[model samples]
Target: MRVVNIHERVYRAEPDALGALLGTLASRGDRLWPVGAWPKMAFDRPLQVGATGGHGPIGYRVEAYRPGRSVWFAFLRPAGFAGGHGLEIEALGEGRTLLRHRLEMTISGVARLSWPLAFRPLHDALVEDALTRAEIELDLPPTVRRWSPRVRVLRWIVSGGSARPQALAG
Candidate 1:
C-alpha cells in the first residue's frame, strides 16, 4: 500500500454550520462522489464501514460521522497490504472548526524499505495542495485575528502556515 495524500483546513463556522456542510455533501453524495459517494450509489445499500471494493480497485468510504462535531472519510486502493486514509473536523470555538487529514499505508519487503524515500515528498505535497483546495471549497477565511492569540496560532498551524497574518489595528 502507498500513502496517497492528506489535507486539512480551518473554518470560522460553528458546528451547526459545519454540520450543514456535511449534510449538503451527504445529500449530494452521488454528485460529490469519491469521498462521499462513488463507484455506486444505492439508497438501500448499507453504509460501508470496513474494507470494501474489490481487487486492485481504488475507493473511499465515510468512516465516521459525529453530527455537530466531526466527519471522517477513508480512501483506499487495493493491495495485499492494509492502511488508512481520512480526515477529522474538530470544533475550535463557537464559530470555528479545525480540519486534519492524514494518509497512511503499509508496505512489506523491498517496497516497504524504499517507501520512505519514494513516497514521502509526494504525499506531503499532495496533502498540502488538497488542504488548500478544501479551504477554498469550505469558504474558510484566510487566518485573521478575530479571536485570541491561542486561536490565531491554531488557525495558523492548521492553514499549513500559508495564511498571511491579519494586520492589527494600532
Candidate 2:
C-alpha cells in the first residue's frame, strides 16, 4: 500500500461560497462524467458516486459531510483496491475559507507495487496541476493568506478526526 497522489488548495472564499461553486461544478452529472458517474441522474441519488471514466469500476463512499464546511469521500476500487479523498474547509477569516484537499492511494498485490513507486510522483504532480487548473476554471479569488508549511502539517494531523457520512442537500 502506497500513496499515489496528493493535491490540495486554499480558496479565498467562505465555505458557503465555495460550496456553491462546487455545487455548480457538480450540478451536471455529465460535467462530472470525466471524473466518474454515468448520467445526470446518478448524481441526483443520495451519496451515490460511481466510476464512469478510465478510473475503472470504482465507487466513492461519503466518509464525512459537514454542511457548508467539509466533505470526505473514499474511492473503493475493485478487488480490494481502495483510496480516500477528502476536502476540508476551515474558516480562516471573515470572508475566507481554507480549502484543503487530501488524497491517499494505496496499491496492493505484486502487480500494483511497481505502480505506486513508478506513478506516485506523476500522480501527485498531476493532482496538483489539476487543482490549479480547477481554481482557474472556477475563477476563484486569490487566497487572502496562505498557511505556513508547519500549520499545514499540523492541520493534516487532525484531519482524520472529521469523518462521518451524511446526505448532501441539493
Candidate 3:
C-alpha cells in the first residue's frame, strides 16, 4: 500500500527563524522534535547528508539536506517501508513561515497492517507534538491537540504497559 502523510503549520515568524530550527534537528540544541516524550532523533554523525539515525524503532538515513531549507530521510527499517520523509521550510509573505513534514512510502508484508492499525495513529500524534514544540519554541501559543484514545493505548502498549495514559496524552 502507498501512504502519504503530511503535517504543516504556519507560524507568525520569519522563515529564517523557522529554518534555524530545522538546522538544529537531532542536535542538543534542537528547537524542534518533541524528544522527551517521544524517542529522541539521534544520528551517528551531525545533521548532514549521509548521517544515519532515527527515533524509537523507525530508522532512516539523511538522504538529502539543505542547511536552512529542508532535509529528507530515506527510510531504512521496519522491513517494508519503501521511500522517504522530509521536513521543509517555506517562506510566506512578511514575517510568516510554513513548516511542513511529509512522508511518502509504500508498505508491504506486516507493515501493510501495522501502518494503518498502530503506526499511523502514533505517528500522527508524534508529529503534532513536534509541531506544538515548534510553536512553543517560537514563543507562540501552542495549538494543542489532544491525543486520540487509540493513540494513548498504543503508546502504552509500545511502552510495555509502563507509560501512564495521562502522560501519553500528547
Per-candidate clash tally: 1, 1, 0
What are the lDDT scores of the predictions, listed in order?
0.46, 0.46, 0.89
Residue 47 lDDT in model 3? 98
Residue lDDT tens for model 3, 28-81: 998898877788999999999999999999999999999999999999998999
Candidate 2: residue pairs that collide: 64-164
- Model 2 misplaced regions, further than 4 Å: 2-5, 29-58, 78-80, 114-122, 137-170
Ordered by TM-score, highest first, the candidates read 3, 2, 1
- Give the TM-score of each candidate: 0.48, 0.53, 0.95
Q: CA shift at 95, candidate 1, in angstroms?
A: 1.8
True-vs-predicted CA distance for residue 37, candidate 2, Å? 16
The residue-by-residue lDDT of candidate 2 on 26-110, one tens digit each, is 3342221113211121333443244222232435666666655555667654444567766566677877666666777666774
Give candidate 2's TM-score.
0.53
Candidate 3 TM-score, C-alpha based: 0.95
* Cα lDDT tens digits for candidate 1, 115-138: 464334434433444444344445
